[model samples]
Target: MTILGFSPGEWFLLVQHELLLFAAFFFLIGAIDELAVDFSWLWLKATGRAGAPPLDSAITQKDRLSGDAAILIPTWEEEQVIEQTVSHMLKVWPQRELRIYVGCYPNDPATMSAAMAAAAGDTRVRIVIHDKQGPTTKADCLNRLYRALCEDESRQGRSAQIVVLHDAEDLVDPAALPLLDEALHCADFVQLPVVPLPQSGSHWIAGHYCEEFAESHGKAMVVRDAVGAALPAAGVGCAIARPILRDLAKTNANAAPFDADALTEDYELGLKVAEMGGQSRFLRLRDGDGRLIATRSYFPATLDAAVRQKTRWLHGIAFQGWEHMGWGTTTGDAWMRLRDRRGPIGALLLAIAYLLLALAGLTFTLEFVGVLPAIELSGGLKLLLWINLAMLLWRAAWRFGFTRSIYGWKQGVMAVLRIPVANIIAIMAARRAITAYLRSFAGVVPTWDKTAHDRHPSSFPSALDAELRFAPLEAKR
Candidate 1:
């Protein structure tokens, strides 16, 4: 005869055990949140009243004068935005010494025609068509361009001092070139903060993008600098010294300048650079009017686009980090390697914490449905909830209260209420990413799942019709 599993008191013990595990997970999340808060506080205190030092003061005039610059734009099917993107680059950029290269595929007639039309009489812009066999990722495109640059240097006996990556959707600030050049005096690689344009018409998506940039670029990068950590390279607004790129090419001959197989090549490169012991700096750029003029691009305007973008990013970052972990050989200086390794783990842990919270909630709900005995809430859970609420308030206040100066209290309250939705989105993205990562590890090559942009092109003011017409082709060139 089968014995019944538990007595009345035994049932209580099982509930207590589950509750303890749940509380333990909550405490772990609270601890991580506390660490983040403490780090942020320390960063703010250390940088108090001390603004970012002037770039001119940080670099010598002689170094600035001697450096040669090149800007690379990699495009696939950006027909609608290419003209406006190129036009803005021509109109706002103050530098006359820049050599601009637009990388495109030969078979894409629409994009090729748009690039040609945009560069009509402009001598500075050179369109390089890659006749590759199949659809490779952006990283492959960058590797091809890098190889071309290397070959050109061999033939012409010239080398670029700095190479900048610009995206088709990015509206770069005019002062970015000089700022990067100045920063290059002190660092080998520099990344500028990027902000999303507010013209997307989806307030929720746009607001989240803005908040992310402000925290990641504005606060997090600054903190990373203070702590002497390697700053992750954002794909666009990145500038790399020729020497570093040359060395990278020589060392990783089998790999592209970026990892073609990886989803987020820019991030991988940044980590690789750090592992190699190089100094990568992030420049916080502001305009002539003293307002921050970060690069503006559109984030996903709809929910579907948002999910797709997040899924792609999550898959890329997770796979790259795991693959590199086993390589064992570290490159960049001590500070760089430590930061690179820590960053991925930190992000992974955060994601795990979010997933655990979701699981705990589900378990709690199931117990209430009588499928399982009701679990008694413990003091540890209540303590963790209070602590988490406080930390969330502090973060919200820092972003909306002090920085944005808009509805601090309201935003802080809303952020707490919206935690369920945010956590759910993150958990779903992470789950999708994990599945993709496993498939990749089992030898499946990832394809470029394209995110459709606002192809209509009528949503925003056209730069082609605005300033590109006034200046002569020669003058603009």
Candidate 2:
């Protein structure tokens, strides 16, 4: 029918169809988000009722020292923070039982020098230069270190029961190593929550990091454990059992334990572990002072760093999800596969939604100016708007309740308001990442997008007051 001659019913039908499709897409995204939130809530409730479990109770003291632990930090041009990272490790961990591996590239003389200086007078810290012949990613460096460790096993004669990955800027909590060792006794892999160091340059970046960590490591991971679903490992603060590492090495020899080709090796490793039928757990480590140990790790303190980091992550997650659709095939469950795909696909949909919203606004304006025909809003349209608004309110309330403190409440409110813009940026980042991945799939390797850290150094106090006012008080020492 011609636009001007179309009957009212026909116009309504077309508008209704468009609205219905949009509503369906919105509802799907909301449902997945809410499900994740609900799972987190249930986990928090259960843990509260059960009381805080003893960190050390998870493993025996004998097991802690029975096998050696390797702390691997992958560094690339991070000379400034490398020393601090190593110093913090030595301060917190007992050097006798734990060996540290600092992976560096031969070209990075400054970082190599700093690493050498950090290792001086400490035999436990070993430096490995990645002088390999090809394209390098963090995963490639990790694989090289793993091979080196395997090769020197005869001389060291250490079992290397647990392998932990930390970034160069991480000021690891003193109790983290012990807690990880304990957690690993029962689970094949363990992940610890990382709180970004507060920086003044951009509150958004810090807030984003905080909210992401809180939900994923704090609440969502607990939920994952309760439901027996596999948990994705955060790149830093993750530990793997020696046997699992060996198996991973054996299975993906050519690629490396952390795939150099993959954008995010940590996440890919987590998926691989799930595929291998190994269980992974996350531990929220608290120190002797009855306070949650918040490590001082640099966030993107500058716009350039923020963009680079986000872009890299966006590309990595999308690439792996799209290219290796059957990585988590052991489960073979249709629902699980869909859930796994949600991260990348959801990101893509979010981006599309923004573009559609803009188009709709422009169309409405044209209709008002007599350039386009007006479309009637039908019952479906009304229902869809109402549903979307309700979901938004529910999510906001859930976040507020979970983060109940005054500062937390303020941050939560601000984050809710910024959701639209933040999501738009995320979508753009994801698209760029996907494009790069497609190119890589066709044999074009992307270089490492190294995020610059804050040069203005800060220190993490060796002692935090035993009482943390914001979070629940920890058990007395």
Candidate 3:
């Protein structure tokens, strides 16, 4: 029967019952999924397998070179922060052991000049100009760098042992190279954790990333390791063995290690390596002073920019991935893929839950004022409702704990408070991602769609002293 024909009492009962069933299905599944991740994290910790291999002495371990490593930094219009990033990175690491290959378009002289100025006569730094025009896909730019490395290798008669990837705004740790080098001895691909510095101007927007990465890098990735799922690279703070890159290039006839057509080439590359029977590791380690070994950078600080960035990720990972990567062979592989593709449905469920909560409040307020009949939930329904509430509390506790582990107690508390804010961003991002994906089929293609960056000024090395330091400042007005 239609709600219009049913009595108010019946209508209220029907709506409440249906909503309860919806909650019982969706949130219960989400809670269970998180429950597994929580348990896996506990197992990793209890067994002492959560930590990285402790070096004999981090600070005292002399400048032992790890052969040769190539660091690839791709830029389109990254003129503002390129100089500082390149300069600081070189100063922080052993210049003789590192070769920084910067990719830029010939049309953009600003970034080219900035990169050249940043290198400042350092023979270790090289700028590779792309043949195409400006703002092509980041993958396209990266491909150019890979080709340059190939030609350089042929000319020099020596190949880099490891290849690393970074975005323009990333601030590398002094220990990141050595650690990545150490980890690569055991695995083909190694991804370190990624930390997004806070922005005061858009706390909700930027802070949400802080909490998200904290939990993902802290807990979810650990679970991924426990289960034999493919390790997805975070685009930065990750390194791959040089030979593996060559194997990946074979798929494209020696053109490039990175896929030029993919939206998230980094994510795809990891999965591709796994498909080729390669082992991957998600390294979550700490430095000598108890600092988490990670790549530090600023995420998009404005709501619109944050949403735009997330939209591209959702389109690439969740939507396009399903079409391109396909279902895997094993149960664990399919399970991980399911989790990867859950973004859109998860956001939709959150929207529905919020709508129902608002409606419930309005209905109860009307009933209390005697404008409508009294409403009530049955015993079974009340029990389910209470269980969901308890699960919310449980999830919030973990979220706070994970955030606290990376950031401090202050940011952890904010993580709990910012759940609603994250949901809003996810909902908006999903909608935009779906639109972008659909538009691609209508003869409109997705290009670089890069997020404009606001690199943390303090994160760069000081002009006064090249000694690298973290100098996060409050967002300006």
Q: Choose the strongest candidate by lDDT.
A: 3
Model 3 deviation from native, Cα RMSD in Å: 3.2
What would the TM-score be for candidate 2 when compared with the true structure? 0.84
- In model 3, where is the ten-residue run with the lowest total lDDT? 463-472
Tens digits of per-residue lDDT, candidate 2, 1-477, equal: 558887654564466457557655666575766676576557677668212343453332332354688888888888888887787688667647788998888778888899888877898899988876323787777888887778668676657888988888787766777777767888899887766543445566555554555555556566565556666677788889988888887776483576777767887787678778898876665554445544546577554556567778767665565465354443333344445455556666675566557767767777789766766666766676677767767766665554443124555665566566556556666666667777875989766677755442235342233225442111111
TM-score of 1: 0.79
- In the range 1-477, model 3's lDDT, one tens digit per residue, is 456789776787578669767866788888888788788789988998766544435532547656789999999888888988898888878648789999999898999999999999998899999999977888888889999999999999999999999999887777788888877888999998888876667777888898899889888888787788888888999999999999888778645777676788888888887888888998776566556677888888788988888898999999888988986777778888889899998888888888888888988887889876786667877777788889999989988988776666777898899999999999999999999889989977779888776564445334112111322224112
| Candidate 3: regions farther than 4 A off | 1-17, 58-64, 369-371, 457-477
Sort the predicted structures by TM-score, highest score first.
Answer: 3, 2, 1
Superposing all C-alpha atoms, what RMSD in Å does each candidate have to the true structure?
6.7, 4.7, 3.2
Backbone clashes, each candidate: 6, 0, 0
Residues forming the 10-long window of minimal summed lDDT in candidate 1? 466-475
- How far out, in Å, is residue 36 in model 3? 0.7
lDDT scores of the candidates, listed in order:
0.62, 0.66, 0.81
Q: Measured by TM-score, how close is model 3 to the native structure?
A: 0.92
Q: By how many angstroms RMSD does model 2 differ from the true structure?
A: 4.7
Residue 310 local lDDT, model 1: 71
